[model samples]
Target: MHAFVVGVAHYPYVGKGLGTGPARRLLDDLGQVTVPEPSAREIAEWLLTAPRQPDDPPIGTVEVLISAPHPVKVRASGGAPVEVESAVHENFRAAFRRWLRRCEASRDNVAIFYFCGHGWRHGDQLLLLEDLGEDPELVLANSVDLGVLRARMHLTGPRLQAYFVDACREVPMDLTLSGSRPRALVDVPEPDGPLHPVDAPVFFSTAMGHSAFGDGGAATPYTEGVIAALEGLGACRKGGQWAVTTSSLAAHLQNIIDWNQVGEGNQEVRIEGQWAGRGVLHSLAGAPMVPFRIGCSPPGTPLPERVTARAMISPSPVSSVQVFEANQGHLSAGFYEIDVAYPPDSRFTGDTILWQIDPPNEVLSLTVRSRLPDRS
Candidate 1:
């Protein structure tokens, strides 16, 4: 697999805090961010250290670019840390070309692209590079038109392509009134031959006209959710093996965002383009562990101090038991018989709850009902 990743956090010309300059004055309304650089580095680390099955493709090349106040370094598997390039327009274009060339070496290769930074929506998504607004006359000279880039990717050799855009889709007021659109950094001629058969899936961090969020000096919530999904949370039993497919990953991301309340409660991830339903992004050696919530029905029923929850694998002796802490825990994917026990003197009674712990649906809620009093 080949990957190209970019994170632009130091937009000297677009935001405040930097020295007063012509470029900064032209686009000082936008705010500066501190999350994209870390987010990009985290994604690159995962790509380098991600586990793969025997049949999976090995990591080929990873080209990363980050725009930050200081030099950024990343380490590959079994290698020393290396400095990455700045996410300037020239650097990004060069890195992209190199990544595309590497991916073109084989049609079976998987191509991945990720970008996190300030972005705007003007009929299409426009990703701002580090040098955005440097040219006062052409404010978008250093930006990329995401839609055009995706269309050009159709002419690439790789059949499976995944794109993650972790940026805002909010429309800039100036651009909205001016009706100006940004041009892509790179342009490709129309293909004379028929376009290649490509399954390109684009994952946007937020819905149209929405802004993505991140904690200052830390990775964004979207990036954290994505890494978690890629690491196994998105895997599902497919053809007798656990695999993380496009659909499963999407579902898992949404679940994580909602369950964790990662962003502003209204932020929603959006998926676009044609997805290969069975395209396996990652294959796991074993079943995925999923989080589960256990509670008694008839909400807030009083229970004894000594309560135990045991989850036994169906048709097998293998089981895991937690004493009182089973109200919330992680369980491996499978059909399980859950037994919750309460003290004899407690109003709540023990009950058996059957549950199917599945992947993608990482969080499962199981409710045990209390046995009624013996009126007879």
Candidate 2:
């Protein structure tokens, strides 16, 4: 069985006063990112279940986590030096290692981890911020090392380790430091591996070397696409390993329309014995218990009659739905009789009909289908 887990750290306060915008955005939209213990069990059950297809595995498990959505963790050291150009001296923080510790209680056939937020590089070493500290020495990127993170994880049997990084800076690691203790950066050997499709002999782990960019019109595009891919694996094609191909993942995420560009694959990073591939991430992107609602104001456009018009009435669907100009078609579904505008759209003529359903990938399909005369 495969298991995935997550821990997050955040930094809310930047240079000045506290604001609600950034954190509030995460209120309902915080995607399920952590792999809990029960979730891990369930995943294993999925892989072991009788195969619906003789060639397919019946059960599988995956875990994911995203933290500090409500608030990026912040802390201050008693006497840390502050830049004179800086407006606010506040520092936010998150308990990533602690949460990771819980996730790593026991490793599986395959495990993946992801860390976002701020990172600094000193020499070849990379450091993720825990919180603010007065001691300037604590800020050194070398203080943390990838090998240390690997040792802290509870990888029991034979398994692959794939580390991904977005943090950009490099820092020197003092081999003498406690977390600096070096371990082999390779896969773990689990004697229990089933050798069948159930066991993921090939697993990839990723860490963004430098992903400190601020959230904007778009959240983390890479992360967003990654989550969508994991959430909709049924929509993906399977190679040897379970993967959501990059093109489809990008298309799913593109629906949000906030991102300007979408990246494809990670090249150059090497994992021992694992084939190099793009569009694959080792982080666990788990499904949420409930559907998350995301609401945003439409981009520069004339005010529609209703607030949810853009979401409710697609641009293309209105054309095939023709109604007498005077006797506008009425929908039996909701209290609000949405005022249908003309020109690009057709009016309804037949008995008022409305199906409470989500729009398909191409709203134009509905219009095209409606234009054809009734087959009956």
Best TM-score goes to which candidate?
A: 1
**What TM-score, over all chains together, does every model reach?**
0.89, 0.35
Error of 1 at 33 (Å): 0.4
Give one digit per residue, the lDDT tens place, for model 2 in 1-376: 2333322333332223222332222122222222221222222233233123333221243333333433221112333422211101121112323334434444432344444433443333333333212122332221244444444343432233333333334232332231322122234455464332111112112222422322342334434433433444213334543333333333343342232232533322212223223333222232211121211123322222221211134434433232223321222121121233323344221222233422112111111112334579
Prediction-by-prediction clash tally:
0, 55
Span of ten consecutive residues with least summed lDDT in model 1:
17-26
RMSD of each: 3.3, 15.2
Error of 2 at 188 (Å): 12
lDDT of each: 0.78, 0.30
Model 1 alpha-carbon miss at residue 133, Å: 0.9
Model 1, position 266, has a per-residue lDDT of: 68
* lDDT per residue as tens, model 1, 252-300: 7888766667345766899987677567778898988776655455567
